[model samples]
Target: MTTNEHINSGEWPLWEIFIRSRQGLDHKHVGSLHAVDAQMAIENARDVYTRRMEGVSIWVVESKHIHASNPADAEAFYDPANDKAYRHPTFYNLPDELKHM
Candidate 1:
């Protein structure tokens, strides 16, 4: 069946795939796939997006479960943080013993 036909058939749910290449790294969205369930989605994502074993971990989330802010309201929602200079650490004076920080 064509891609559109398969999607419209409702036989599979769309999943968003995220991969972490190594330990301590954040999982980044790579792509998406369609599957019958979460386990199948995870397996399919690993196979499709990590053929060369680039990822040490994978996460598959149903597209329907994700909620995101509208891009148009980004400035109104996030711009307020930019005006708060005290939230930053530029003025902080750490002790000499805190060299790692």
Candidate 2:
């Protein structure tokens, strides 16, 4: 089948996999793969990314479900958030217990 035909067949959907090695760590994007469903995607991710048993957990997200900003709009999209100083804790007077943070 042609690439377009295969893609439009709907039998395979691209999934982005995130893996967390341990409990305290956050899940990081490992790679993408094609799968028929969520369960298949998870299985494929485990096989592809955790061959050495490195990951304790896996999250498979359909690529289409992810909404991301365009790199071209980076400045316009992220500049506002950067100027919000109150979002940072630097303005707060922390107690001795929390000051170490």
Candidate 3:
């Protein structure tokens, strides 16, 4: 890619785009694209990902800012959340028949 294509393809990184389909839920990863600046990233992501009325809010994250768990650390890291069942809303067991998830 050209310098105009991104800031630092491997280091400075590309940004990810997220959008909220509704007001009550967290924004979700819709897609990603690179740009020289955040303003351009947002604009580009909006046009590229949200061409339809698929979102009400938008969020952008420089790819580096996100810290994903390494596959090797899966058990040592995410295992705690699993043990701490309180972290989940298991108390409210909704039947599959429920309309709203």
RMSD for each model, in Å, please?
4.4, 4.2, 6.8
Cand. 3 TM to true fold? 0.63
Model 1 segments beyond 4 Å from truth? 1-8
**What TM-score would each prediction reach against the true structure?**
0.80, 0.73, 0.63
Expressed as tens digits, the lDDT of each residue in 17-79 for candidate 2 is 999997547999888998877898899998899999779999999888899889999899888
Query: Which residue pairs show backbone clashes in model 3?
Result: none
Show where candidate 2 strays beyond 4 Å. 1-11, 81-87, 97-100
**lDDT per residue (tens digit) for residues 1-101 in model 1:** 44356567866778899999965479999999988778988899888999987798999888878999999999999998997999889789999888777
**How does each model score on lDDT?**
0.85, 0.85, 0.77
List of clashing residue pairs for candidate 2: none
Q: Which candidate leads in TM-score? A: 1
Question: On a 0 to 1 TM-score scale, where does candidate 2 land against the true structure?
Answer: 0.73
As for candidate 1, its clashing pairs are none
Ranking by TM-score: 1, 2, 3
What's the C-alpha lDDT at position 38 in model 3? Answer: 79
Tens-digit lDDT track of model 3 for 1-101: 54444455553347889988865498999877876767878888889887887887889987768898799988888777876777678678898898866
Query: Number of the top candidate by lDDT?
Result: 1
